[model samples]
Target: MKYSILVMASPTAGQGSATAVSFARSLLARGHTLHNVFFQGDAVGNGLANAIFPQDERNLVGEWAALAEQHKIELILCISSALRRGVLDKVEAHRYERAASTLHPAFTIGGLGQLVDASANSDRLITFGH
Candidate 1:
C-alpha cells in the first residue's frame, strides 16, 4: 500500500513526530510505499534547519533526514505554517527580505495542494497528532 502521513506536532514538544517516524519506518520495512510525509502546524518546526538538540538526546531532525534520504520519501512542510514559525525556503527568504532560509535540505516547502494531491494519490492518509 501507498501511505501518506500528516504530522501535526512539534518534534521536540510531543510524541507525535516520533510516532510518525516509527510508523513510516515500519511501513517501509513491511514493503509499503510512502507517497509523502506532510508536516503541518507545529510539526513544520521539525524541518527548521536551525533546530538544535542536546548531545544527550536523540537528534529527531537528523533521524528524520536520514530516513527521508534512505527511503526517498517526499518530506513536505506546510508553507503557511512554516512561515508563521519562521521556517523559510530560499525563495521565501528572498521575497521577505530575510537574512537566510531556515528550511532544511531534507524537506520541501510546499502548499496545501501537495497534501490534497498526496491524499488523492495514496492508499492511506494517516495523521499523527496530539
Candidate 2:
C-alpha cells in the first residue's frame, strides 16, 4: 500500500509526530511505500533547523530526517504555515529579505499543491493531529 501522512500537531507537545514516524516505519517494514509526509500548522516546526532538545528527550527532528533519508520519503512543509512560523527556505528567505532560511535539507517548504498531489497519487492519506 502507498500512504501519505498529514501531521498537524507540534512535535514537542503531543504524540502526533512520533505516531506518524512510527506508523511510517511500520508501513515500510511491512513492505509498503510512503508517498509523502506533509507538515501543517505547528507541525511545520518539525522541520526547523534550530530546535534544541534535552539529552533525555528523543530528537524528533533528527528522527524525521533519518526517516526521510533512509526511506527516501518526501517531507513537505506547508509554505504559508511554515512562513508564518518563521520556517523559510532559501528562496523564501531571499524573496522576503529574511536573515536566513531555517528549513532543513530533509524537508522542502512547499504549498498546498504538494498535498493535493500527494492525495491524488497515494492510495491513502492519513492525518495525525491533536
Candidate 3:
C-alpha cells in the first residue's frame, strides 16, 4: 500500500508529531510505501534543524531527518507556515535577508500543491492532527 502523512502538531509540545513518525515506521515495517510527509501548521517545527532538545528528551527533528534519509521519504513543510514560524531554508533565508536558515536538510519547503499531489497519488492520506 502507498501512504502519505500529514502532521499538524507542534514538534515539541505534544505527541501528535511523534505519533506520526512512529506510525510512519510501522507502515514501512508492514511493507507499505511512504509517498511523503507534509508538515503543516505547527508541525513545520519538526523541520527546524537547530532545535536543541535536552539530553533526556527525544530529539524529534533529528529522528524525522534520520527516518527520511534511511527510507528515502520526502519530508515537506508548508512554505508559508514555516516562514511564519521562522523555519527557513538557505534560499529562503537569503531571500528574506536573514543571516541563516534553520531548516533541516532532509526536509523541503513546499506549498499545498505538494500535499494535493501526494493525496492524489497515494492510497491513503493519513492526518495526525486537526
Candidate 4:
C-alpha cells in the first residue's frame, strides 16, 4: 500500500510525533511505500535545522530526516504553518530577508496543494494528532 502521513504535533511537545515516526517505520518494514510525510502546525519542528535533543533521547527530527533519506521519501513542511512558526527554506528565508533558512535540507517547504496531492495519490492518508 501507498501511505502518506500528516503530522500535527511538535516533536518535543508530546508523543504524537514519535508515534507517527514509529508508525512510518513499521509501514516501511511491512513493505508499504510511503508517498510523503507532511509536517503542519507545530509538527514543523520536525524540520528545524537547529533542534537539540538530549544525548540519551531520540532526536525526532534527525530520525525523520534519516528515514526520508534512506527510503527516498518526500518530507514536506507546510509553508504557511512553517512561516508562522519561523521555519524557512533557503528561498523563503531569502524572500523574507531572514538571516538564514531554519529548516533542514531533508524537508521541502510546500503549500497545502502538496498535501492535497499526497492524499489523492496515496491509498492511505494517516494523520497524527490533529
lDDT of each: 0.92, 0.93, 0.94, 0.94
Cα TM-score per model: 0.97, 0.97, 0.97, 0.97
Which pairs of residues have clashing backbones in candidate 2? none
RMSD of 4: 0.8
- Runs of candidate 4 with Cα error greater than 4 angstroms are none
lDDT tens digits, residue span 22-129, model 2? 888899999989999999999998999999889998888989999999989999999999999999999999999999989888999988999999999999999999
Give residue 85's lDDT in candidate 1 (0 to 100): 94
Prediction 3 global C-alpha lDDT:
0.94
Task: In candidate 1, list every pair of residues with a backbone clash.
Answer: none
Q: What value of lDDT does candidate 4 attain over all alpha carbons?
A: 0.94
Report the Cα lDDT for candidate 1.
Answer: 0.92
Residue 15 in model 2: lDDT: 94
How high is the lDDT of residue 112 in model 2? 95
Give the per-residue lDDT digits (tens) of candidate 4, residues 29-124. 999999999989999989999999999999998999999889999999999999999999989999999999899998999999999999899999
TM-score, cand. 4 vs. native: 0.97
- After superposing candidate 2, which stretches have Cα over 4 Å from the reference? none
Error of 4 at 62 (Å): 0.6
lDDT of 3 by residue, 25-127 (tens): 9999999999999999999999998899999988899889989999999999999999999999999999999999999999999999999999999999999
Clashing pairs in 4: none
* Model 1 Cα shift for residue 32 (angstroms): 0.1
